[model samples]
Target: MSRATRRGGTGRSLRTTFSIARPHLRGHGLLIAGGMATLLVEVVLRVLEPWPIKVVVDAVSVSLGADSGATAGLPAATVPLLLACGVLLLGLVGLRAIAQYCSTIAFALVGSRVATALRARVFAHLQSLGLGYHSHAKAGDTVQRVIGDIGRLQEVAVTAGLPLVGNIVTLVVLSVVMLVLDPLLAVVVLLAAGAYLLLSRRGAPRITAAARSTRRSEGDLANTAAETLGAIRVVQAYGLEGQRAEAFDRGNARALSQGVKSRRLAAALERSTDVIVGLALAVVLVAGGWRVIDGAMTPGDLVIFTMYLKIALRPLKDLAKYTGRIARATASGERVAELLEERVDIADRPGTPPLGPVSGDIRFDAVTVDDGHGRRLFDELTLDIAAGETVCLLGPSGAGKSTLAGLLTRTSDPFSGAVRIDGVDVRDATVSSVRGSVTVVLQESVLFAASVRDNIRAGRPDASDADVERAARRALAHDFVTALPRGYDTVLGGRGDTLSGGQRQRIAIARALLRDAPIVVLDEATTGLDPAARAAVAASIAELTRGRTTLSVTHDATSVRDADRIVWLEDGRIVEDGTPRSLLADPGSRVAAWFRESLQEAS
Candidate 1:
C-alpha cells in the first residue's frame, strides 16, 4: 500500500479491476467492436492523407530540375495535377473527421451504459453486505466510491481510455507504414518511440502512487465531513466547532497536497516527452537530408518521412498524458473492486427454503455467540418462549440484551447453535422470509424522507392506506399525522427528525402494527421519552403485542412489570429467570434491587 516496494502491484491491481468490469461490459461487445473499426478507418485515412502532398512535392521538384535523379515516377506538375492533390487531401480529412466522430459517440454510449450498470451493482452489493461489515464502515467513504469514482471511470472512458486505445493502435499502424516506406529512417522513428515508452515506464509507479494517495486522502476527508455533519448536534452542544474544523482542515490539506503532487508528476512526464520528440525530429531531418542530397531518396520522400514522424509524434506525446489519466482511473477502479468483492457472511444457506406460517414459538437452542472480539456472549445457553408469551430481558450495558435481539433477527449469526421460529432454524430458511415473520421497534426509529403513509407502509408494502391510518391511530400517531400540512400525505424530514421523539416512536410503533407479524421485539423502545410520551408509546406497544410472542430487551426496571417472565442477564449469562411477581417477592433478587434503583432515580 506504500509508494514503493513493487512494480507488479500496479499491473495486478489493473488486471483485477478489469476482471471486475468484465461482467458489466457484457452485451456491449458489438458496439465496442464497431468503435474500434472506426478507429482503424481513421488511422488508414491519416496515413493516406500525406500521400497526395508527397505527389505534389515530387512533381514540383522535377519541374524545377532539382531531382531528375530521385523523382523517377513523379507526376507531371500541371494545373490538373495540383487540383487533384488538393481535392484528395480535402477528401481524406473529411473522411477521417467522420470516422473520429462515429468512434467517439460509440465509445461514449458504451461508457455510460457500463458505468451505470456498475454503480447499480456496487450499490446493491453494499446494501446486501452484513451488518457486521456496515458497523465498521464509513458511509461517506463508501458513497464516494459508488458515485464519484465510478463517474470518473465513465468520463475517462471517453476522454482518456477510448482515445488512448485508439492512439495506441494508430501508433502501431503508423510505425508499420514508416518501415515499409524506408527501413533505415523507420529505425529513428521506432527508437524515439521506445525511449518515450521507457521514460513513461520509469515514471508510472510514482504517478500511480500519487494517484492512490490522493484518492485515499479524499476519502478520509469525506469521512471526516460526514462524521462531523452527522454529529453536528453534539458538536454545537459541546461547543467543539473549532476542533471539528481543525480535523477537517488537516484532511483537506493532505488531499490537496497529494492531488498537486500527482498533477505535477504527470506534467513533468509530458514535458520530458516533448524534448524526446524534438530530438527524434532533428535526427530524422538530418538523415533524410543526406539521402536526398545523395539522390538515394527524393525530396518528396524526405517530406513524407518528416510528415509521418510528426503524425506519429501526436500519439507518442498523448500516450504520456493518457497514462497518467489511466493511473488515476485505475486507483478508483481498485477501490470499487474492493467494495464489490466484499464477502457476504449473513446471507441464507444455499437451497434454504422460505419460512412457513409461524405460531411464534421462539427458541435459542444451546446457542454459543461471540461479540466479534473473541468475547463469549452466550456459551451453551438454551432458552425457549412458547406461543404468544411475553418474555422481557433485563441487562446492563454490554450484557448482550440488544445482542440477543440481534440473534433472533439474524443481524449476526451465532458462533454455534440455532435460533428457531417454531421448529424451523432461522439460518435453515431464506433470510428475507425469516425476518419477515418478525417486527422490531428500536430505541431510535429510523424513517425515510417520504410521505407518512409510505413510511408506515414500509413494514408491509401491500398494506392499504386505510390499514396504515388504522395502525397509526392504534399507535397514538394518527392525531399528529392528521395535524401536519398534508395529513398522512405529508412528507417527513430525514430520519423523521421533523417530529418529536414521542411522535417518531408512535410512527415506528404504527409501522410495527401494520406489519402484524407473529413475533415482536422492543429494544428499549420507550427509553428516551418523557413520562407522557412513555405512557402513550407503552399503550401502543401493549396493543401491538396483544397476541404475539414478544421479547422486550430493556434497561428500564419499570418496563418489565407487564411481562409474563423476566430474565436478568450479566456478563453473557442469565443470573435470574422467573415470573416478575416472584422476583419482586424476593427483596435480595437483582430485579427487586433494580426496581428499587429505578424508583429512587425517579424520586
Candidate 2:
C-alpha cells in the first residue's frame, strides 16, 4: 500500500483532523463564538470599505466636469464633498483595522488554548499507555507527535481555519452585492471563481500527498536527532560520530526535499489563482468601460463593481495559498489521532476496588507467562512470600527474574493465572492501588532534573520537608545532600548526571523509602558500584528493607546472605528454596555451587 493509503488517505485524514479538533474547539465555544463575531464585524467593515473610494471618484469626476450647473443643485461645494469623502475613507480604514485586530486576537487566544489542552491530553495519554507499549515504542517518534504535530494544529486554527472562514464569509456577502450592482459582471466573477475552485480541487490530492510526505519526513528527522543525541555518550565512546552525522544528514535531506516539493506545489496553485483573477478583472474592466462609453454606465458604478469583485475574490486567492497548510495540518492531526486511539492494555477493570494498605503477602498462583514470542518464561509457577519477608531471587540472566518483578508491579500481565498481593488478585484491584502498595528501584537508577528534595518527594507528593529528610537519612543520602551548595534544594542535572553513580542510587532508594510501600523491590541495586559505594548502598538497602517485605534480585552473595530465604531458579522452574545458611552449607546443592562461583568471580 502507498504511504497515503496506509495513513487512511487525505479524505479520512481530514475527517480525523476535525474529530480531534472538534472537542478542543467545543471546549472553548464562548471564545470561538466571540472570535466569529469579531470576524463578522470585520467582514462587514471590509464590504463597506470600498464605498468611500467610490464616493471620492464620483466627486472628483463632477468637480472636473464641464457642467458647473451640476454643483448648483448640490447641498455642498465640490471641495467640501472631496474633503468629506477623504475623512470617511480615513474613518473606514481605522475602524476596519480595529475590527481586524480584535478578530485576530480572539482567534489566536482560541488557537493557543486548544493547542495547550491537546498537548496536555496527549502527554497524559502517553503516560497511561503503560510500560509494554512504551518498551516497544520509540521515544523520539512519540515526542514528535505530542509536541510537533500538536503544534501544527494550533497554526491551522489561527492561520488557516479562522482566515478561511472569514474570507469565505466575505466572498459570499460581496458576491450578493456584486449581483445587485451588475448581473453581467457578477456572472463573469462567478465563472472565474468556479474555474479557480475546479482547478484547485484537481491539485488537492497531490498537495495533500506531498504535505503528508513532508510531515513524515520531518518526524523521521526529529527521531533521528533525538536518538543520536540521547545516545551521545555511547556514540562518542565508540567513535561513531561520523556514522551518526551521516544518518542525520540523510533524514534532514529527505525532509528538505519533501518540504520543497510541497512548497512548489503550493506556489503553482497560487500563481494559477493570480492568473485567473487577473483575467476576470480584465474582462470586467473591458466590458464596463465599453458600457460607460455607450452611456449605459457611470464611472463610479464601474469602479464600485471592480472593487467589489476584487474583495469577493480575495479569499479565493488566499484559499489557494492556504491549501498546503490545511493539508499539512491534516497529516499531523492523523498522527495525533492514531496515538490517542491506542488501547490502554493495562487499566483497572470496571468496579475494581482500590487495594488498601496490605501486610505485603505476595503470591503467584499457577502463573504462566510467555516472552511475547514463543518462549514460555514461566509455566504454572507458584510461589509465596509472607508479610515482611526478605526473599532473594537468585538466577542467571534471562531466568525471568525481572519479568517476575514486572508481574508484581502490574507492568505486564501473566498469560494465564493470577498474581496477588495479600490474597487479593492484582487484576481485581485498581492499578493505582496496586502500585501504591509496591515500590521498586531498578538496576539503573532513573532520576529527573530537579531539586534533590523534590525528587525524593515525588514518591509521596504530600511528604513534608522533615519527612523527606527522614527518608534521605534512612537511605544514607541525607549527609551528602546537605553538604551540597544548596543542601536539599540543590538541583541535579539531567538524569541526575551531576551526582555520582552511588549517590544517584541512594537518592533512588530514598525516593522508594519515602513511598514507604509495604512491598519493596531491589533489582540488582548494587550491581555496578565500587567496593566503598557498594558497601554504602548495601547499608542503605539494609535500612530500607528493615520492616518491609523485600524482594531482591541479585547475584551479590552479600545480599543473598542477609535474605530470610533464598529462591533459586533455572529454566523458569524453582530449582531450590531454603534459608541461605542451610543452602550454602549443602556442598552438593546447585544453589550453593552457583553462589560459590559468583563469589570466586568477584574475587
Candidate 3:
C-alpha cells in the first residue's frame, strides 16, 4: 500500500515471486515458445480480419449509387463479391479461434506444472526451517501461504495473464497498421491508451491496498478456525462456543469488506476506460466523415480506420479487468515468497561426513546455551557418560535438563561449546545423521492416524514387518495391538487419541526399540499415566533402553530408582551426582529433599 501504488513498485512483487519460482519453470521452454508462436499467428490473423469487412462495406456503397469503387477484375455480380468477402471473414475468424485455443492450453499447462513444483518445494522448505521459527509460526497462516496463496498465482496466470499477453500484442500491431492507413485517426488510439494509463495510475493504489488487506484478514480467519478446531475439546469443556463464533464472524466480515472494496475499485477503473474509449470513437467518427466527403479518404479506408480503432481500444478493457486480478495475486505471491526465504536453522557444514556408527560414549564439553533472552542455561558446564550407562537427570523446571537431549539430536546447536557423540562433534556431521543415531520418546508421543504396524515401522523405514512385531512384543504392546478390531492394520484417530495413554506409550517404545540407536532418551515419558499404566510402561522402558546409553529425565522417584547414576541440576549446574542409593542415603541430600517436597505437594 505504501509504495506499491507507484509505477515501478507495483510490479516489483510480481517480478520477485516469479523469479523465486523460475527454477520450477524450467524444462517447459518448448511449450512456452510454442504458445508465443501460436499467439503470433493469431495477431496476424486479426490484422487481416478488418480487410474483409472493409471490402463488404465498399461493395455495398458502390451498389447504392455511390462512387464507382475499385471492383477487381470481372466480379460483375455484387452477390458474388459479398459472398466471397463473407467466406474470407469466416475463414480468418475460424483460424484465429484455433490459435487461441492452442495458445491457452499451452500456457495453462506451464502454469499448472510450475505451481505444483513450487508448492512442493515450499512445503519441504517449511519443514527444514528451525524449531525456533516454527515455535512462533501459526499453523493456519502457514497453511494459507503454502496452499491458498500459491493457488492464486496459478489461477491468475491462466485466466488473466495469458489473455493479457495476446491482447497487448494485438494492440501494438493494430496501432501500427492504423498509422499507415491514416496518421491522424491513429492519434485517437494513442490518446485513448494514455488516458487509460492515467486512470490506472490514479486508481491502482486503492486496489492494491484493498487486496493486501483482504489477504491478511483471510490469514487471520484461517488461523482462528485452525486454533479453535485444534482445541475443540477444551473449548467445549469451557462452554465457549459463542465466543469462538463471534471471533470467526469478526474475521469473516473484515475480509468481506476489503474484498468488496477491491472489486469496486477495479470496476470503476474498467467503466472509466469505457468512457475514455467512447469519446475517442466519437471524435474519429466526426473527423473521418468529413475527410471521406472531401475525397481525401475513401469510404473503405474510413471503415478500416474505425475497425482498427475498436481493435486497438480492446486492450484497454483487458488491462482494466486483469489489473485487479493481478494485484490480488501479487499480494498472495509475496506471502509465499516471504516464507520460502526463511533460513534453514540446522544443516550440515561444508565437507562434513554423515554420522556413521558410534560407541555410546557422550560428552558435553564446556557447553553453553543461551535461551535467546540473555540468560544462559549452561555456561561452560561439562558432563560425560561412559558407554552403555544409564543416567537420570532430575531438576525443577527450566534447569536445562531437556536442553541436553535437544543438543544430542541437533535440534539446536549449543551457543558456545560442543556436544560430542564419542569423539565427533554433533555440529560437524549432517543433521539427519546426528538425529538418526539417537532415539527419543517424549512425554507427548506424537503418532499419525495409521495402522499400528505403520506407526511402529516409522522409526526405521526399512524395518521389516517381522522386525516391527518383534519390537512390539519386547515393548509389551503386541497383545493389545492384536486385540484391536483389525489387529495391527486397525487405523487410529488423529494423534492416536483412540488408544489409552499406556497403549500409546508402549507403541512409541516399540518404535524406539525398532530404531535401535546407540543412545536413547526418555523425557518425562510416563508423567500423565495412571499408577497401573505407569508401572506397565515402566517395564517396557527397561527393555527399550537396555545396553544403550540411556537418559531418563523425570521427577518420578519410581521411574529413576534403578538408574546407575542420578544428576540433580539447579541454576544451570549439576548440584548432586551419585547413584540413587548413595544420594538417598544422605538425609540432607538435594535429591532426597526434592523427593520430600514432591510428596508434600502431592498430598
Question: What is candidate 3's CA lDDT for residue 231?
Answer: 89
TM-scores for all candidates: the values are 0.96, 0.94, 0.94
In model 3, which residue pairs have backbone atoms overlapping below 3 Å?
none
- Model 1 segments more than 4 A misplaced: 1-8
Compared with the true structure, all predictions reach lDDT values of 0.88, 0.86, 0.87
lDDT of 2 by residue, 1-603 (tens): 333236655577788788876787776788778878888988988888887777666556666661243222223237777787789888888988888788889889988888898899889889888677788777788898898899998888788888899999999998888888888889997898899879887877788888878878888888888888878889999999999999989998999999899888988999999999999999999998887666556666789888888888888899998988988898788788878887797888888999987999999998998887889988999999999999999888899998898888888899899999999999999999999999998878899999999999999999999999999999999899999999999999988888998999999999999999999988999998898999999998888888899998997877788899999877878989999999999999877899889889989
lDDT of 1 at 346: 81
Clashes of each: 0, 0, 0
Q: How would you encode candidate 3's per-residue C-alpha lDDT over 1-603 as one tens digit per residue?
A: 223223234568678667767998789999999999999999999899998878877667666655643433212328788889889999999999999999999999999999999999999999888777888888898999899989999999999999899889999999889888888988888999999999998887678768878988999999999999988989999999999999999999999999999999999999999999899999999999988887667677788888888888988998998889988988887778778777787887899999778888999999998776788998888889988999999988999899877888877888888999988899888888888889999988888889999999999999999999999999999999999999989999988989999999999999999999999998999998988989889999999988999988987877667898999988888889999998988899999888778788767
Best by TM-score: 1
lDDT of 3: 0.87
Clashes of 3: 0
Worst 10 residues of 3 by lDDT: 68-77
| TM-score, model 3 to reference | 0.94
Per-residue lDDT over 482-583 for candidate 1, one digit per residue giving the tens place of the 0 to 100 score = 999999999998889899998999999999999999999999999988999998889999999999999998766777888999988887788999999999
Candidate 1 CA-lDDT value: 0.88
